[model samples]
Target chain A: MAILNLKKIGVSGVNSALHKIVENSEKDFEIRNPQGQHSIACGINAPLNVEIKGHVGFYCGGMNKYAKILIHGHAGVGVGENMMSGYIHVKGDTSESAGATAHGGFLVIEGNASSRCGISMKGVDIVVGGSVGHMSGFMAQSGNLVICGDAKDALGDSIYEANIFVRGEVSELGADCIEKEVRPEHSAKISKLLKSSGINANPTDFRRYGSARQLYNFDVDNFESY
Target chain B: MSEDIPKTHPRKSATFDDYTLSEIRRAAATGIYDIRGGGAKRSVPGLDDLLFLGASLSRYPLEGYREYCGTDIVLGSRFATNPLKLKIPITIAGMSFGSLSAQAKEALGRGASIAGTSTTTGDGGMTKEEREQSEILIYQYLPSRYGMNPDDLRKADAIEIVVGQGAKPGGGGMLLGQKISDRVAEMRNLPKGIDQRSACRHPDWTGPDDLEIKIHELREISDWKKPIFIKIGGARPYYDTALSVKAGADVIVIDGMQGGTAATQEVFIENVGQPTLACIRPAVKALQELGMHRKVQLIVSGGIRNGADVAKAIALGADAVSIGTAALVALGDNNPELEDEYKKLGTTAGAFDDWHEGLDPAGISTQDPDLSKRLDPVTAGRKLSNYLKVMTMELQTIARACGKSHVLNLEPEDLVALTVEAAAIAQVPLCGTDWIPGKKNEILLS
Candidate 1:
């Protein structure tokens, strides 16, 4: 597999190189020292393994399909944004807006992630091992947000159609972000997800949160003047 | 101590509203006339005065107001097209709550819906009021992605990727630090009192190459069903339109400099952009060269005043026209009743545009409680609807006068340009001429 030294190219030229890697490389490829820049690995539908080292800018693994991307360092805003179907792992700290609006994928951030981690997330399974920032899953429509560590603030503001489980302190819950009963239906699934993500945390320590469906159909009676 | 350079010296004195003194002050401040945004601010010939040359031997004029004037349209007929079916060509332009007050935006949506068109939400997150009132909501995907969600994207009738706006072409948004209320702040995930600085370039895209991927990401996020539109400020629009089409945009929304905003630097407003008059022709030219002219429905905005202007814009190759300033006016902004308030603000009626101050007397311009109360959504919405209907009728009258059954049927042959800029860009003929460059087709204007 080819090693793409990202410092050698500008942001615009990176896509072609990644596309070439997807076409040419059979095994996982390695990219080194990528400073914060946009669109590191976009629209790759192949079932390939890609590792990006160093801080990455927005949309690192966006529109990803079938490929598995691993970022070794910190990530900028909107990392793994809008990923269709893939696996994205951020080993270090992440900036605000990680995993924004991803349709279907598994996003795992090992360290702390800033606010709006799973904003408008769709059909993705996000697992944050460390503490998560404020508004972690603001307006999340579907999918799941699992925080093993402390959740800073507004854990799930204006959330709808999403399953959320937080293991630690939630500074504040967002509007319409309500707690739901964690019945026997979710026990097996939660435990399996925690173990697979390499986190041996107790499933019983987590509490589930989701939408109240209050703002779905806006009416004078239902609308809250916001 | 009375020093040599006194505080009240001639140099420090007011020149009594003297034109020359003000001119000197302006000249000292800047070398040229200061302006901003992307529309024509200079006085150039417009479609208002242009009398169409109806069909003589080959073409004929339809009875004015009697014959049908078809204005129906569907965008994204090209490679990357929106899947929406529109009954009318006119659609509401995206205006943010941070720009225009909450009420004004609601009124625009009301008007658009009444006219069987679509309304769009801007940089701010979707307001429940807008979603409830608007029949078809075109949710905007801005760089900030404020309040963006997969559910909203899927729920929207269409999605517009706003790369830039006409008001501050290539410049980031600045809704002054003062306007950020608790709600606005909460909506944007910003500090309550901090200046809202938007990144001019989207974080997801570094250039056209990345834009392609971003579009794909959006398509993936939305499950590839909703129509996706790429909006650009009218700067280098010829290439912007073509490249956007290449980058997988189903529809291209081209906004010219004349488009209004709630708040922009005064310097940027008057000086930065080509007039809407100049933007249309080049965009159409680029579309024609790519052979995607009418295929990619072009929606043009900026300085659209009367129905005649709308008709001209469409004849010049726009599928429809979107208005911001006009729509606001229809809702009683600058109304004579607010003259007292205008006087208090050091301006007069019809001249007070304190849109920056958020003290809108007509609720259509401000989020203030007393001011917002002045604007009854239902009544104001109806007025806006009436205005839109009148504009459409005027356009129909013009189309019929040009002997065309449909607004789109009014060809370029019906127009004549008085200036070279107008001629070259608008594709209209020189005044008193059957002679158009490469006039290989029917000559009706002669």
Candidate 2:
């Protein structure tokens, strides 16, 4: 484990430093900075734990796998994009498109997330404790998006294999996003995620959303007008 | 607005058909044809009664409405390793407003949203009205490539790269000058009424190898949060479907002949492509051979009209089905109230003249102000919803009779073809036994 203090490092220094650490270091590391900057900890393969104390910019921990990323402050747009597998935790608010298109992994955001969070997610689990912006989880295939607070408009449009759970008011669901009962598997998963996210566990409060499995592809009979 | 302007003069009182033909002529040059989207110019076998051969001893019908007719389909299973999980199997096909009235396009969005399915955008950029009305909006990134913005991309539920359409296979989309409004022109970044020419190939890449990279780039641009669909006209669909999978498409949309368009060359509409029935089996064969069927999720469109057509398409191995012409009919296109207008055009209600010109009496196809105004979006959408219900009912009945819980389970094993073309394309035995080509599927996959 290596400790990298950010009292003296700004965006440029931190970006350069993290790039170097990513190149040279291969284990768990602590990055001490509290400011938000773009492209923090992008594309790292080796298993590592990256701890960021402050806010970050677009694409923080993007396309990363085999690593555990913990952000103490808020995050910018497109946080944890296309992640293959790993764990990411954000303590504060996140900008648009949080945990977008992640195939496999766990992305836990303790605060509100902006629009399009978990868009096209394949097999990832995105847990947002607060409200999310519009068009969240659009066209997602396989994955789980859990919003502790409310979900904005167009919740799940033309979705495939993904499942969504929102606890608070749903501004409006997209083309799809029907309410489904929380089953035992879902209860167990939510219970564990609540524990990992450091929140009080109450799995029953959340409403599950998944494909009515109606519009998986295209069918003529379903399209009456056609 | 004058309830009866000189627009309908006895001497100049033209039928909706006449206006469209003249408009098309004005939009055309010496030999060049005007273009757009919509349905058939010539009559062919449409989605009326390609009746199903229901089961007997091993099958029993379920109660129609009470029966659980599951239409669930999974997309992007094989190629992307990740696909869009849609709730229903019915989806709206792509239709652009640059070639149509704004009201017409909005109605499409509203209708699709009401039905709990997805609506697709045309070649132009994402419209705010569409975004607002559409529950699941699939944005198209076309060869012409208008309105390709990252903000909309991120917001989109999925991205469809439209290669070509069924009515005009290997041909690009066209918006005649008469239909081009100021707002439509601005949004498309092209001059109004200048005969818009779309890109023949994608601006992003040259070949299939490059297409793979472009797909990745699109994922990166959206932060990997949108399902990417590759749509192609039913020309060499077996190869196209196989290659699109290789290029990493989550879903494959294969459009066949009889698919509608706003405007296309009359020649292209009549010629240039295989029938919808012929095209579907080849595409399905490709996916099944590669073990990508049901995994990659194949959507087949063209000439789809009724519940029987829908059931037949599913039985042929399509994960889903799309419609254009049937949608128009449901929206009140062939209404008998427009009978007088049709007489003036030398046609009738069910036989309305043409779709290319911007002068539809029902206000479904044209861009003309008065013509389009005739269609009230609210009323039109309600009709569309009703129409959609009928289709669902038809399919449910078929699904029940077939002894299947879901319409999607109505497989080829339950069907037999009446024609050699139908049997060959459908891959079922020639009306009696099971004698499909094993090498045919392998060839398509290869």
Candidate 3:
């Protein structure tokens, strides 16, 4: 393990340091004095474990691939955006569009997430420990979004094949999204996801939601829903 | 008695034309707005409305074949460590694999590589064949992010952040169920045989301020190697161009309403964006105002057809021009030979635009395996390369006649408009008169 201080090398030098670490086949790294700098530790292709000491700004760990990034403090907008095949664990709350449009990854947020969380999420499995704000999972395509706490308005609006499991109450369901019965397989899946995300909650307590399939094909009768 | 009285001539109303009546009937029958492909069919002020004034007494013309007129250009030289170097100023525009067949995409790549130019990937992510065939491939990061991945981003020579397109400026993308094959479905992470509607706005970023950050993230991701281009429709070229430059773009691509699409509402295509002729000047003006005209290159598209259109676009201060519809035409799309098959589809050879239905006889815009097999990549690529060569030669010929050594040296002063609308829109003087419709008033006020 090696430690790189942002205060010494500056934010611009982070990429070169990451490249050097990857070239050397280094497995672990610790970044100190992050100070909410944007795009920190982003676009990492190699598989490595990285720990950020302080808060990070927008697009932290964006477009990540085959890496594990752990942020100790709060994250700004678009954290873990468009990530593919990686793991991002945010210990504190995150701003808007968490795990947005990610193709394949696992994002675990220990605290609450703001509006538009998992917006247009493709195949990323996201588990948020606390509540999520309005319009969360808007136009979500595929994946599993697990919310242990309450959800704000318009949850999973215009959703696609993605499954949403919420342990707490949902204020309202968006158009075309409906609650579903959680079967034994769904409980097992939820339980496995919770175990992976380090969340200790009863899988049966969560209720599943998904697309109603009514708005799959555009029809004259579904004009009102659109 | 009837002959002597003179038969009353049957009159037809100009307001309700034949085409208009047919369209009305179509709307009443289908209940859904007509969704099709290709560009605007309506006539507008285009490159044809402007003509170049060849050198006479005051200027010396370059010898046609003796003196060399350069057409080579470097795009995204502002920031990218490696910019695209092209033999000609004409490049192929973005057309997705799902919208076009895999064979078509391969043909585009092979043709572009032969012409020493670049081909782009569209809303659909980069295909394996497209990447392998194209020497210089520009990857489009669209709102859908369908097949977007970090590995593909690194593989691309350039990155184009799509804000809007000319065919449907503020609208999203639609691929009907007929086109979504197993391959397309797997790539987009959607079920097969479902109507996929791409988002109009990007999921993460919203405004220009956020766009700047987004650009920075991409730059960081790619290690600042690839040129970043911001593509916008011709709705508000001036503001969009300026804002793209401000957002740290290495290049800007402006597409006009005449630009082609795979599938979109006909009403949105014909009614929405500005003409290619009307879009160039404002975008150029914006770049000039920012003092980044040549520094941040501009690639204009929409209705560019031949070398004349390419030369005209360059004369209007564009660095390069892209072609979509014309390229398809060169690849045997809308061929007169396919007229009978087209008639079976209820359209003519040159009039077939229902690309969304996936019943294309020409095999250029379809996903059906049997239809897609009609196109041979090698033969079609050869034809496209030949067409690209002809267009380049034509541009060079025009540049020589205008007494310019390079295609980039062809200026607006060398062009005159044949129509008042063209003079006003292109800001060029009308032929035989020093009067430019709008500039004359500005000159008088000054």
Instruction: List, for all models, the DockQ compared with the true complex.
Output: 0.06, 0.02, 0.79
lDDT of 1 at B125: 64
Q: Residue-wise lDDT of candidate 2 within B308-350, one digit each (tens)?
A: 7878888888888887777778778878988998787666888
lDDT of each: 0.73, 0.73, 0.92
Candidates ranked by TM-score: 3, 1, 2
Tell me each candidate's RMSD, in Å, in order.
12.9, 19.6, 2.0
The 10-residue segment with the lowest total lDDT in model 3 chain B: B437-446
Alpha-carbon runs more than 4 Å astray in model 1: A1-78, A82-226, B1-45, B55-58, B79-82, B435-446
Alpha carbon lDDT of residue B95, candidate 2? Answer: 81
The per-candidate count of clashes, in order, stands at: 19, 43, 0
TM-score of chain B of each: 0.87, 0.85, 0.98
Docking quality tier of model 1? incorrect
User: What TM-score number comes out for model 3?
Assistant: 0.98
Give per-residue CA lDDT, model 1, range B337-426, as digits (tens).
Answer: 888877887667666655756666667655566777777777888888888888888888878877888888766777877654466567
Writing each residue's lDDT as its tens digit, candidate 3 over B1-446 gives: 56588787888789998988999998888777788999888888899999999899977899998898999999999989999899999999999989999999999999999999999999879999999999999999999899999889999999999999888888889999899999999999888998888999998899899999999899888888899999999999999999999999999999999999999999999999999998999999999999999999999999899999999999999999999999999999999999899999999988999998898888989999999999999889889999999999999999999999999999999999899899999999888788899657543321
Stretches of model 2 off by over 4 angstroms after superposition: A1-226, B1-37, B40-50, B76-87, B343-347, B432-446
Instruction: Report fnat for all candidates as fractions from 0 to 1.
Output: 0.05, 0.00, 0.71
Best by DockQ: 3
